[model samples]
Target: MDAAARARLIRALAGTVIAHADELTGLDQAIGDGDHGLNMKRGFETVLAEADTLAAQPLPAMLAGIGKTLVMRVGGASGPLYGTLFLTLGKTLPEESGMADAAPALEAAVAAVKARGKSDAGQKTMLDVLVPVLEELKAGGEGLPARLAATAHAAAEATVPMRAVRGRASFLGERSVGHMDPGARSSALMVEAVVTWLEEQA
Candidate 1:
C-alpha cells in the first residue's frame, strides 16, 4: 500500500475500534477486566488526534509512532499486546509493502504477540483472530482483504466456544467458553477495517 493508503487504513482501524468500543467492553465484562474497550478507544483517539503528524512521516515510522502512542496511552493487557503487534510490523516490514511482501512481517508480529502473551492459537486470546488472518494472508487468493476479513470475523466468533487457557479469562475455566474474547473481537475489527479500506480503494 502507498503512504495515503497506510494512513487511511490506520484511521479506519481506529474508527472501527471506537465504534465497537461498547461491544468490546461488554464482552470483556463477561470474561475479563472490562477495560479493553475504553483503553482501545483512548489509544485510537490519540491516533486520530495525531493523524496529521503521523501522516507526515514514512509509513513504518508512523506505525512505530502509533504503537508507542498506544503503549503510552492505553492501559491493561491490550496496550502492550496491540502495541507490540504494530511495533513488530513497523520494525520488520520494508518501507513499502504489498500483502505478499508483508506476510513475513505479519507472521513475525503474530509470533511476537504469542510470545509476549505466552499464548497461542485456540487459547481464546487475540490469536484466535490474528492467526486466521495471517493464515489467510499467507494462503493468498483473489480478494485477499475480503478473505482475511472473513477469516478474522469467523475466528473472533469461534472464540465464544473456546475455553480460555490464558490471561484473565482463564481463571473462569469453562465459564469463559460462552463469552467472546474482547481482544479477538478487536483484532477482527482491525482486519475488517482493512477490508473496508481496501474495498474503498477499488
Candidate 2:
C-alpha cells in the first residue's frame, strides 16, 4: 500500500474504535471493568497522532509500530492481547503481502492472541469474533470483504449468549451470558472498519 493508503487504513481503524468508545464502555459495564472503550480510544488516538510516521514505513513495520504503541498506551488486558495480535501479524506477514499471505498471517496472529490471553473461541472473548473471521479469510472466495464483516458481526453477537470463561467477565459467571463481550464488539468494529476500507479500495 502507498503512504496515503496506509494513512487511510490507520484512520479507519482508529476512528472506528474512537467512534464506538461509548458503546464499548457500555458493554464492558455489563460484565467487565467498563474501561475497554476509554482504553481503546486512548490507544488509537495515539496511533492517529503517529499516522504519518507509521504510514512512511513498510506495512510490516507499520503494523509492528502500531502494536507497540498500543501495548504502551492502552490500559488493561486489552493492551497486551491486541498488541500480540498485531505484533504477530507484523512478524508473519511480508512487507508486501497479497491475499495469499493474509490468512496464514492472521492465523499466526490469532494463535498469539490465544497464547497471550490464555483463551480460545466460545469464551465470550474477542477470540469468538476473531476465530470466525479467520475462518472466513481462510475460506476466501467472492465478496470476501463483505463476508468478513458479516462474519465478524455475527460472531460478536453470538458472544452475547455465551457465559464468559476468561478475562474480567469470567467473574460474572452465568451473569455474563446476557451481555455481549466488549472486546468482541470492539474487535468486530475494527474488522468492519478494515473490511469497509478494503471494499472501498476495490
Candidate 3:
C-alpha cells in the first residue's frame, strides 16, 4: 500500500468503529458491562490521532504498532483479542503482501485470536465473523471485497441465534440468544469498512 492508502485504511477502520460506538454499546448492554463501544471508541480515537505516524511505518511494523496501541489503550477482553489478531498478522505477513499472502496471514491471525480468547467460531464472539471472513478470503474469487463484506455481516448476524459460550455474554446462558454479539458486530463493521475502502481504491 502507498502512504495515502495506508492513511485511508487506518481512517476507515478507526472511523467505522468510532462512528458505531453507540450501537456496539447497545449490543453489549444486553449481556455485558455495556462498555464495549466506549472502550473501542477510545482505542480507535487514539489510533486516529496517531494515524500519520502509523501510516509512515512499513506495513508489518504499522500493524504491530497498532496492535500494541490497542493492547495499551483498549480495556476488557477485546483489547487482548484484537491486539493478538493484529500482532499475529504483523508477524506472519510480508511487508509487501499480495492477496495470496493475505489468506495465510489472516489464518495465522485467526489462530492467534482463538488462542488469546480461548474460543472458536461457534462461541458467539468476534471469531464468528472473522473465521467466515477468512474462509471467504481463502476462496479467492471475483468481487472478493464485496463478498467479504457480505460474509462478514452475515456471520455477525448468525451469532444472534447462538447462545454465548465465551466472554461476559456467556454468563447469560440462554438469555444471550436473540442478541448480536458485540465483538462480532464490531469485527464485521471493521471488515466492511476495510473492504469498502479497497473497493473504492480498485
Candidate 4:
C-alpha cells in the first residue's frame, strides 16, 4: 500500500459511514451512545478534506493530518482512540510505503489503539478486530496481508456474540449481548475495505 491506498481506505470508510450513518446511529442508539455514526462520519470527512492537501507529503504526514482531525473534531472515546491509531501508524510507517510495508506499522497501531482504549479482544471494542489483524501480521509477517485481512474480518464477525465489556455499550451489560458494538463494526468495515483493496491489487 502507498499513500493512494491509504487515502482510498479513508475515502471508502467515509463513504460507508455516510451511507450507513443512520444505521450506525441506530445501532449505537440501541446499546451505546447514539452518536457513533455521526461522529465517525464527521471524522472521516475531515480525513478526506485533509487528504486533498496532503498530496505532497509522505503517506504518514497525510494520515497524521487525519489523526489530528479526528482528535479535534470527533467526540467521545473513538476520537482519541482512532487518532492515536492513525498517529502511531503515521509515526512508525515507512516513508515510501503505506500498508504494503505495513506489518510493523499496523502492529504499532493495534498497540496504540489498545493502550488508548484500555480494552482488548473479547471486550467488544475495536480491538476485537484489530488484535487478530496484528497477530496475523506478526505471525505471518510480510506475507500475512491477506491473512491479516481475513483475521480482521473474522474478528469483526466474532463480535456479534460477545457482549460489550467496555465503553458506552458496556452499560447495557447483558442487553448488549446480541447486537454488535458500532465502533467495532466500523473498525471491521475499515479493515475489510483494506482487505478488499489489497485483493484487488493482487
Q: Write the per-residue lDDT of candidate 3 for residues 1-202, one digit (tens) a residue.
A: 8878888989999999999999999999998999999999999999999998999988788888889989999999999989999889889999897778989999999999999899999999999999999999999989899999999999999999999999999999999999999999999999999898888888
Q: What TM-score would candidate 4 get against the native?
A: 0.87
TM-score of each: 0.96, 0.99, 0.99, 0.87
* Model 4 error, position 3 (Å): 5.9
Over 1-103, each residue of candidate 4 has an lDDT whose tens digit, in order, gives: 4657666666765676667778778878988889988998888777677665654467788767778888998888889998898888889887778445677
- Order of candidate numbers by TM-score, starting with the best: 2, 3, 1, 4
Arrange candidates, best lDDT first.
2, 3, 1, 4
lDDT: which candidate is best?
2
Q: Is candidate 1 or candidate 2 better by TM-score?
A: 2
Q: What is the per-residue lDDT of model 2 for residues 98-187, given as tens digits with 9 covering 90 to 100?
A: 889999999999999999999999889999999999999999999899999999999999998899999999999899989999999999
Greater TM-score among 1 and 4 belongs to 1
Better of 1 and 3 by TM-score: 3
After aligning candidate 2 to the native by TM-score, how far in Å is the CA of 136 from where it should be?
0.5
Quote the lDDT for 150 in model 4: 72
**In model 4, which regions exceed 4 Å deviation?**
1-7, 98-100, 141-146
